[model samples]
Target: MAKKAYIGVDGVARKVKKGYIGIGKNVYGPELLSTAGMPFMALANKYYATHYHVDQDGGFATLELDTLVSSPADIIGKWWPDGSFGSDSVETMITSRIRTAVSYSGLIIHTEAYEITEQTVGIARKIRKAYVGVGGVARPCWSGGELVYYGTATALSVARQHLAATSVGNYALFGGGETTNNSNVIDAYDASLTRTNPTTLSAARTQPAGTAAGDYALFAGGYGSNYSSGVDAYDVSLTRTNPTALSAARTQLAGTAAGDYALFAGGYNSRGFSAVVDAYDASLTRTNPTVLSTARCDLAATSVGNYALFGGGQISSSSSSAVVDAYDTGLTRTTPTGLSTTRYQLAATTVEDYALFAGGNASGGYSTVVDAYDASLTRTTPTALSEARYRPAATTVEGYALFAGGFSSGGYSTVVDAYDASLTRTTPTALGEARDQLAGTTVGNFALFAGGYTGSFSNRVDVYMVS
Candidate 1:
């Protein structure tokens, strides 16, 4: 039940002539009880009422529930009472009501008064909420401020291998791979970690390279029944358009974006190893940039600052190469100090100021070397991975570079190694399944490793969330 009441100018409680009663979203008694009358329901179900009384009559009405109720834990953080407090007396009245709301009703509302500046005094402040994680605890400052409703073990719609991953706007996408046959499925995860199947690729091709620039996420070059030069571009809204294809149709190429350009460099074509470098600008304009110094296949690519770097790949079937190629925003090519180890199938990602290239097969044995390049392209060696593995999935989230699930001497690995911004290494929880050839990318606060071969093709998606 609710009563018609408001606070007087003298800070005294008084009954008012007009108001309504409401409970759990339903307005029960009296005149024209609309949505605004149902306070409990309007609070987005955050609190429940054993008994109720609230007032919304005229000058600074307050929440007057019989006994306040809330969850076991207090919703901590700065919050502003909805409307304007015109005078100091009104502010004091509102603070008193908040105290009453917390004291009688058990809701631990923190009514800390912020020092009002010229900017903050007259403006209305928004009520902020947070994302709740597992164990019903809220994780601070994330999108979709609601209870943790999404479930884990989120797998791709199809099982695949040799897939490619990239992110643009609010979504991270995994595209093109081989399953029973070549698959064109593009699985998407949005900011809320909800999965959606966007339009499939125009061509079903294995080992297509994925990257993003401006409003577009692009998948370019790979082998279908034949080598495909087709370039499929998806905008931030997941709307698909075919950009101009690559200069040469190829497979095992590397793709990355720097500044305003998305680039595809070095791959095996029908003509054997090709050194072609194709670039697409923000407007989807295609240009042939200076190619890689060495023609290679299965190279790794990552970007940091204003440059994109492609490093370490099989220069020939019998051996790997340490050749590291870089392209600045202007598409000018430079050969940086190569990786300390001549290796291919290495994985690369960015963390803070460095672009790290980690573990790959070098010689006959798997290599554990980890190399880092700063924004100025200065190279440094970081602490190596706990396990020597090749083809691990790599991505960054919350300043941490995560390398997950690859193959080593003992066979398939479930180990997940992480490196912070300072290059300090730590091992987090392992993947649910041991696999390799999976694709990895970030969306919001999550780093996801999806789809791989675990003896057989697997559709498992392992998510590491920074809460």
Candidate 2:
């Protein structure tokens, strides 16, 4: 009988000529097998004849023909016929079977020393976990635990906990009062809590005007045991054992600091209400006092860029005057512009280039009207306040001009009202204490009200922190 062979053609068993193989409809050419230098059909026949058994009917028996015709060790050294093999064929077969088994088993294939070129292993299944080289030298080795990882068996771990934290937007408040010592007291607050003690003033006083120059707060004339002409210097950021006094003693002075100098304007002195203006430099030396054409007290004063303005106040006649004066600081005092109505003891705050003058004592007692003036002393038509008052303190906080603690119609007021530059006033908020003649200063985000007279003279210091 001619040598018989069973071949798999498209997964179906078929009998073919011993020297030929069929693929699809056409039988393969002899050159196709000959050029490849292999009798594929003959090899298949030999494999089946030697390994498979014949059945009772003389036809080839169903054969368990899965046994290898060549050992893996043997296949390693040669091709099928001449005992020389194609490159990596055995390794390819083994790796293919391994990958298939691993996939079928649903397990991760751990590997070592696997080459990672653009081809071959690059395209291999799950090769990321595979090993390469015979000695397992190249491997995906991890030295540390899950919290750590390895690169070349070196452990690198991350911090399981966090690091230290820091803070921002923090600030300090300086030069105010507390609940004791009627005068000569200076305190500081931070973060809503008092951070410093009341640094004793050189002399006890209230309603003294203050201006900050660097770390120092220069306090000009205010009512002490008497109307004080004495100017005192307190280091706003430091504890004071001693304070330097002014060349002249006066009170109800309006002052503002600019650059290295603090300027004090019209105030009440022993000579009565005076228009004297004085400038104190960094060295605490006072310049010769320049006189204003109008002598007044309880006026509002502020520095706008290069010019200092002194607005409505009580004239020497004890009547409120509408005069507005501007001091060049570099030059002598000039004639002042008059207001629509006379006002005194008013609260003044600067908003950009304009100064807003709010509630003060007008002709009929306390007037609620508010006024605006440009740095050049041009006045705007007055807007009315929510409540008419005098001895009220004004400060600009967070773009709003706040008027706080003054004597109104009934009595002393703890009411706090805020006005925008547009002259619109908001509903007032009550303070912790009702007071008048209070010295108000702003430190950071908080406004400090210190040493004012309540129904009785008070040493109570209250702070308002604008959130």
Candidate 3:
């Protein structure tokens, strides 16, 4: 049996060598086996011992036995022996003491260079991965750690947690946040998870929010020395441009794409928790929409095909609130089902027509409860995250909604969870570092979490492969 399925180094599954390899069998006796050259594959079966061997050039060789054997195909391998058995045991046994050119013994295994196939490599069911050697030699490379091949393993790029992240097409940019101090650093990650700090933000802003607008991306209000009103915009060419500031500076806000516009809503301003909802057109001009029904900050937001919704946040007095706000493509405001569990500093992401809200701080403490909202805005509670956390990051990657890194009840978390279309939650992998207050976005097939408060505020970026 030939295996066609393989997971490449890029985390993409592929099929290789899509045709059958012909292996014909021929039995060799004493005379034919003595001078057999090149590599030969042999299968010893029960019944009167008949050895079926095929040479590298596909020539057939045979070995006839007088006695009967109990088992068949037990010692199946391709061996390159020089006429003499030397120290070979499986071949030496050859019908229990029946002498062959190789050896005369029992249960002899070919100690010389030999090859095994997927069918006989281990328990017959598992498909063995084959490595095509230099110069076109193909052989099974399984059974754990036999040889090391370059360019066959997955690669890791820098992880930028705690920083705000947004993507367009095949690239994602992470900018600003606390890393040692409130960081001014800005970087970009490509579809392959490669990281490069191509440009700098005009201002150092932490806990900022961003969304893609046309071919460009806008980094809206964040916390600098104080709440920031400055907005930074980057286009397809990575050009840095300025957009008008919000009517008031704010940080920890939730921003999402609404039709062709980007809307930034509820967060803290100098005046306290903000109810201001700022909408920006493609030109980055500001348009104030109806404010959030409930004034709050540290909320999470995500856009469905037609609208954007903001869910869960801290209300006026650092108190967690579970209220939700839905904005139509026209920027009209409507109330949706509140979170089953009241929470703040939560995260949300969408897939198809369903949006999932996960991991936030509730009344008692940090909450691990997860809730999903369908197209009609009905709420369905999914399985909770592996760890209860607050201020984690969320995004859609390869059809799965991912939540990564945050401050959990156990402290800072590096845990990452993925939700499939069925709303089933699975912890596929962990972030490189533990942190929170971060931002996340998707580009191509990847979901990324960047910049967050690890110990004393961090600027780490961690990536996960969802494809």
- Count backbone clashes in candidate 2: 27
Scored against the true structure, residue 60 in model 3 reaches a CA lDDT of 29
Q: Which scores greater on lDDT, model 2 or model 3?
A: 3
Model 2 weakest lDDT span, ten residues long: 158-167
Order the candidates by TM-score, highest first.
1, 3, 2
lDDT of 2 at 431: 67
In TM-score terms, candidate 2 sits at: 0.57
What CA root-mean-square deviation does each model show from the true structure?
12.8, 30.7, 14.7
Q: Write the per-residue lDDT of candidate 2 for residues 320-437, one digit (tens) a residue.
A: 8888777675635665566667888887777555677777888788878777776676777545776778878766653456777788987888777765444556654566667776
Stretches of candidate 1 off by over 4 Å are 1-153
Evaluate residue 257 in candidate 2 and report its C-alpha lDDT on the 0 to 100 scale: 56
lDDT-better candidate, 1 vs 2: 1
Q: Tens digits of per-residue lDDT for model 1 on 157-236? A: 99999999999999999999999899899999998778999999998999999999899999998889999998999999
In order of lDDT, best first, we have: 1, 3, 2
lDDT of 3 by residue, 157-268 (tens): 2323446778866678777766545666767777676766656788877778888777778888888888898888888768888888887899988888888888899989
Clashes of each: 1, 27, 31
Off by over 4 Å in 2: 1-182, 223-227, 239-245, 329-332, 457-466
